[model samples]
Target: MGSINYDDSDVLDVLIIGAGISGINAAYRLHDELPDKKYLILENREQLGGTWDLFKYPGIRSDSDLHTFGYAFKEWTGADIAEGKEILTYLKKVAADNGIEERIRYKTRVNSADWSTEERCWFVSTEQDGQQKQYRSRFLYTCTGYYDYDAALKADIPGIQNFKGKVVHPQFWDLKEDDYRGKRVAVIGSGATAITLIPSMAEVTKDITLVQRSPTYILSLEKYDPIAKVLRAVLPQKMAAFVIRQKNIARIYASYHIFRTFPGVAKKILGRLTSMQLPKDIPLDPHFKPNYNPWDQRLCICPDGDFYKTLREGKAHIATGHIDQVTNNEIILKNGERIPCDIIVTATGLKLHVGGKIATSVDKKLIKASERFVWKGCMIEGLPNYALSIGYTNASWTLGSDCTAQYVVRMIKHMDKYHKSMVVPEPSNRDQLEEGPLLDLTSTYVKKAEKDLPKAATTGPWRMRTNYWYDLVQAKYGGYDELVFQ
Candidate 1:
């Protein structure tokens, strides 16, 4: 592909893509540190709140809490596990409060980004309002996340088209257009989304069955913390909120260490806790038991024990087996059981994608992302003057993103001080480094995209880590010895 130009194109110091949590945090960091730098946010959707706004399915909420998930600069004074709408509203407020809303161009879809070594800038081709346009920026921060919006990752169930009832994924759900009331709904998968949807949708639907290949570790916490309430009642709001967030952060950090280090003990403890949530009548071993240990995969978090309550009340049922085929009015299980269904929801999770489907090249040579190395869990190896905002898998995503945003600001300031036009991270010896999965996860989605995902190093700044305090020290305060500034 050749470079294209637009007459009305205006150059910028930075171009932030996707105005979700990462983009908002990036904007705030840039505004605070480099007030004079010119920047623009190109969002493909017509609105803000990337995941929260896009997934409008029933029982939509954060699997993680607001403290770490929220920005480091702002305090989320609402419930820990906030509803999707509330979270989206919070993101919009953050953007508006920081004066970043005016700088956003909605309905702008980025098709490709090409980096020019001669110009030291990225030429981005985009389609906005059905018009082809181009924009140039010295720095490109991709907050587009790692998922495909138009397509969802679902198991290719045999004979799905023959099903008489409607089949849907959580990504394309429209409640107004299709009603589930008085319907027998079958929700597939056992991820956080399916667990949340089964309970939330069961309240309105006649009977909903959760179909799962295997069970996931389930956990619960109150929507509102009593500790937060007492602290806020006694102390000032900001101080209380800050202390609470810190306390929660510490607890969660310790839990990750414990679960990883002592899987046997952690699994037993998690199983006991999960069993406590259910009533005596409901059997625990068959439905709630998982073969994997705790923290092997993400624990499904339910607020106020709603999912367990739904199961105990007989509003929903659990079916564990593979699908044989989808008939006209039901799904036949491999075990020869036919599950009647009026609607089938394949809450089978999302596929991992990077760069928001942007066809990228450097110096007219196409850049194959899977063949590159990941640096500090954000930037890619051999990619200069650009950073990608990817959050931590274990902890809240914003925690890592916040640190990366600060690092980007720091790099920009460093280049400005040295009068350098470009900065790249070059490992002392790339071939000698040991490599593994970018995201050290065992989930099906991660496994499916293993070939396309970037490689993670065994040690040093090149490795993508998950610890918050450690990442802050390495990314924010660590020296740029590995970075080439010129």
Candidate 2:
């Protein structure tokens, strides 16, 4: 990628990538904390909302509750689990509320970024309306998620084209083109997407079948929190929300600890829950039982046993078997059983791409994303004036987003006070232990891209983690003594 030539006048204080949840949060933080700085947001997609806007399937919703997923500055008064459209609306409203919408550039795609040591900034090449353009910025903040937007992680099932019925991935479902009404639908994969799609599709489709080679741990949570409701009614909105949010955060911490501490107890409880949801005749050994401990994969849930109800009502079925092949109107199982269906929804997963697939180089040396370590799970190991936002795997995404955005602002203020132009965190002692995968998740997406993702230092700030509170302390105050600024 060649550089875009322009005069020195064309420079900005900050340039943000992707107008999703994290981008909006970064914009708002910069506006409030560093209002004098110039910033622009470049979003490739036509609209905002990021993940919520992209996924348009019938039952698209967040697995995490709204209380934690909602921004720290904003209190979520809606249902615990909100629909995708609702999340999009919330993001739009946040943008509008903060006056950040006007600074966003829609349909702008970033191709590459190069950092100059002499210039002390980044030169970014982008595409808008098939025309290439360039921009320069002192700081670059990327909130683009760690997944490929153009493709999904689909398995190489034999004869995908031979399936006579319509085939689609839930990530790209469109209301205008496909509808499952009166159709026998077969949704493959047992992850969060499959769990969310099944109960909702059962409403419109004649019958829905979720086929899985293995089982995932599914737990049920209440749709509404009575304590939250009472607090909201009794106290001022912010105070009440603060209390509820703290309680919820504590609950999440306790739950994750419990899952990790007593795998046997957790397994029994989850198994019992699954057995209670199914009919007495249905076997739980292979269909609902998982071979791994809880929290190895994310635990999915729906309000008040709706998923269990859907299964008991016979509107949906769970088939545990490997796929032999897909014929014209049926999916043959390796166990010799065949399922008749009119549609096949590949709810496999996503392709994780670090740095949003942007080609980055420093001083003309290519920056291999996999070669470096994550700096407190936000910045690249040796990169300066750059930060990335990725939320917690165990808790609400916004928790990490809010904390990281604020932390970056604080670092910026610290730099300004000291007349420093650049700051980067380097691992103090990486040779002490072996480098490990950046993420501990066992999900298909994580495993698929483990080799490509960044590594984590076993100790110090470079150690990537998943706990919100632990990360909060680290991001806010830790590593200040170690960071080198010039």
Candidate 3:
């Protein structure tokens, strides 16, 4: 109930927030590289696997392939794109195998973190077991991710309250309680969640309709990768995983560059591929065709073309238009078209909440993340002994977070070797650098959180390059001249 002191052995060398992918990777790196250092991970949830544990909607799976999404330190043997439960199992195994499970404090919610210049340590206030607790650590790392776990982005649906049928949001879906057997369902939004839910809930429901304001770029890919199978057959498990990971990385990277460089040609090719898999009755114009260029926003991936297959099998339908109103039985489009439904699923986009909604301050002055610049894609400007993991938009999330974890470990080791207590990022000529959004995506979530997220420069270590290969080498051997070691 009272404040804790870092004066003696009670303090930890490193305190990690979250038990998600980034946090797990950081924990592994700390134990592997700095074995002598004492650290602990605080997980707000009772269970591990942050995203996989939170969402329980039907057909919940990783959009990115597991080969790249899984940690580099571990080899993944599951399907390329695995379901939520499978991924959660994998995470649990990783934690147990590495002994990270013992280092975690479950159901611990970090409320605020303050850096004391005099003590050269972080004072973290948390709520655990219905009691306020405090912990001190020399370094603080946040892996709570970029989205709000407590809330999702709210959509403006007119007359939604008037609907007599049950309304549900994918974020708050209950697997055990909710039943949709033989009931007509309407899923709103066309992002990855909506696209996934449509195919997953199609067979169980009588009929499912995908209701979207506009179309998003969608691509069909083989879920069980044939190339990975061949690689594993010829190589050792770890060797094969490494090779497969690099292959997947390069494939996505080259495709992303091609899509950006020649959007017209790329669009034509993608459109043709999507059309080939879709039914003739479902035109490419109104439903499949997107207004934006490929990679402008994340492309919705359907494993083994399941989304398209469901449409062909007459289990699913897509209606693209602005919602005019929602009656008790049907959703009226602005064009006067109507689609009847008994259940409404709002799969609206995620809401970005940086630093896990944990207030951070230095010497009692609040640290505004928006005003700070990202240093080496990990540390924030003027923030001492702190780092947050934000992954790449184009590739696997782990690929980016792994780099951050390693980079953070490197910084920690460097400070130890030099006998320094604080390492702070200070911009060199901040006024001259051209600043822009940290993430290079035009997604709705990114746009809405622009004022809350940190800024990135166009040049130097402050820039956040989307390339994993480049980041891998840079994170290992990058210069730290911009950082002031105290």
Candidate 4:
């Protein structure tokens, strides 16, 4: 196919926003399944691996095991749970190996995408370094995972600006020269970022205090990928891939079962294991206990109890209290205790935006995402020739996302046979459909948008199932006949 001109007539088969893991995988699947289609992956950043490239704080690693976190087609050859840098490298390798790197347009941010009813195409506008460009495509796939582009920083806290010390947020860490060696530091928030950063920074910092509003449940697990590596070595590549996938699915389901069937037993076991790692007298009550069940929100994971070990060794301290306000040189707690620090790191959670908050319009009528039902968590009701690769909060993100991508490929192939130009979710009776929140409100992202988000049917895998195996079976291999296409 010849390169089309840059005008309105330049039509593409697919236009993917966000060159992150989801977009990358979707592009790979498209290339492998339908080689004739033209696709482009647009990313705002100069590089690939969106979040992994953006976050470079200490002790950055996968919260879930690599067996499940890694790509379905690609086996994770590493021996342990992969770190951020390794994952980035793996992503780059995947792009190179699949020859999909050329399709990516970096430093290009999508501004808006409007569906043109007359043309039956999406008119996409993007800006790159102050210059605006436009493209039209038959399908627009949004893979921008949740999380706003801006880091969540609370720099407006009282006296925070007056502090005559170095201050930073993990999301905006500078890679050039700022060092934390032998300096007193206070890390705020107790989410995965804080849990990972505090213990890792404590090794170099003279003293570290972890300040939190509420306690988060932290669990530790071994990171070895022995079975993954062994299978890759002993069996054929395809067979090894199948074996690893089965093992990972089983492990994921076991954990899910434990959390569902025996909450008390699972909690007790996890708490006991945590207590065994902490200091003898450290209060585990209001400080370490969580109000909700595990996986309701993401359970904080630390490999090998590193955070507890750091606290026990006096290198780190957990301040299980509320922050009254920040003073010039210290953080005052609600109980009136003041902790002095030379540096403060705010590990506050991220704000999630679905489809990167892309503005969509049909026939110049603005389409509100919240008003439409999510079809398989990818395509939306009334939207045609479009799908997203959104992940579940409770499982490895890659697993669900990969499943969604595979489904998209299947749907596209099915469309190819009929010479179809578009696909959309069939309208369902609103009164008959059961409704519930699309995401748990406890999650920082979900809470922010709870008021305006679309409600899902309380039944069906597309509605509420967060399990990996069930989702794979239903989304990847089932329901192609049911989806409406034209």
lDDT of 2 at 175: 45
- Candidate 4 TM-score versus the reference: 0.93
Clash count of each predicted structure: 0, 0, 0, 0
* lDDT of every model, 2 decimals: 0.86, 0.84, 0.89, 0.78
lDDT of 2 by residue, 185-277 (tens): 999999888999888889888889998989898888888888888999999999998888889999888988898899999999899988887
Per-residue lDDT over 93-161 for candidate 3, one digit per residue giving the tens place of the 0 to 100 score:
988887788888999999999999999999999999998999999999999988999998888999999
Off by over 4 Å in 4: 1-9, 151-162, 175-178, 226-238, 480-483
Q: Candidate 4 lDDT, tens digit per residue, 1-486?
A: 233223333698889898888888898888887777888888999999988998889878888777678788787767446789998999999998887788888988887888886787999888877889998998899999877776563434556777788888888887332377888888888898988988788878888888887888888766666677788889998788778877877877788668868888777877887778888767787668877777677788888778888888988988877788887889998888787998888887776667776778777787888877777777877778888777877777888788788888888877778888778886446567777777754855567766566556676533854777777777667875335767
Q: Pick the candidate with the highest TM-score.
A: 3
**Cα TM-score of candidate 1:** 0.96
TM per prediction: 0.96, 0.96, 0.97, 0.93
**Top candidate by lDDT:** 3
Better of 1 and 4 by lDDT: 1
Evaluated at residue 295, the lDDT of candidate 2 is: 91
RMSD from true fold, candidate 4: 2.7
How does candidate 4 score on lDDT?
0.78
Better of 1 and 3 by TM-score: 3
- lDDT string for model 1 (1-486, tens) is 111232336788899999888988998899888887888889999998999989989879999889778876888889989999999999999888777887789999999898998999999999999999899999989999888888898778888899988888998986642389889999988999998898888878888998887888888899998888888899887888788888788988899889999999998898898888777876677778888777778888899989998988989888887899889989888989788999999988898998788888887778787998888887888888889988878888888888889989988998899899998778888978898778877888988988997778888878868788887887667788678887
